[model samples]
Target: MARKYQRANRMNWLMPVLFALPLLCLAGAALLLWGDQLRDLINIAVKLAVIS
Candidate 1:
């Protein structure tokens, strides 16, 4: 009985995060897809020089 109670306690804390993972992933994907359009952003430029 004591072990069961402890397991439930752990799951109570963990369950919400497990359930929210998919929504978090979806939000991240949406942000990546539309973030530039929604804000002013710049791409980094790389410089290369040829050795003489």
Candidate 2:
């Protein structure tokens, strides 16, 4: 019973990570696809900050 509980506990923590992995992969792919736009936004933000 203790061993089964331990296994369940381990899976509880792991399940969310398993579910999030695909979402993380999609986010990474999106970043890669729009990296140039992200960089441009960062540059604009920096320029505005410096101006202020």
Best candidate according to TM-score: 2
RMSD of each: 6.8, 3.8
- The estimated TM-scores of all candidates read 0.48, 0.53
Task: Put down candidate 2 lDDT per residue, 2-24, tens digits, no spaces.
Answer: 99999988888788889999999
lDDT per residue for candidate 1 within 1-52, as digits (tens), equals 9999998888888888989999999999988998886554323222233333
Off by over 4 Å in 2: 1-14
Clashes of each: 0, 0
Q: Residue 8 in candidate 1 has what lDDT?
A: 88
Off by over 4 Å in 1: 1-9, 40-52
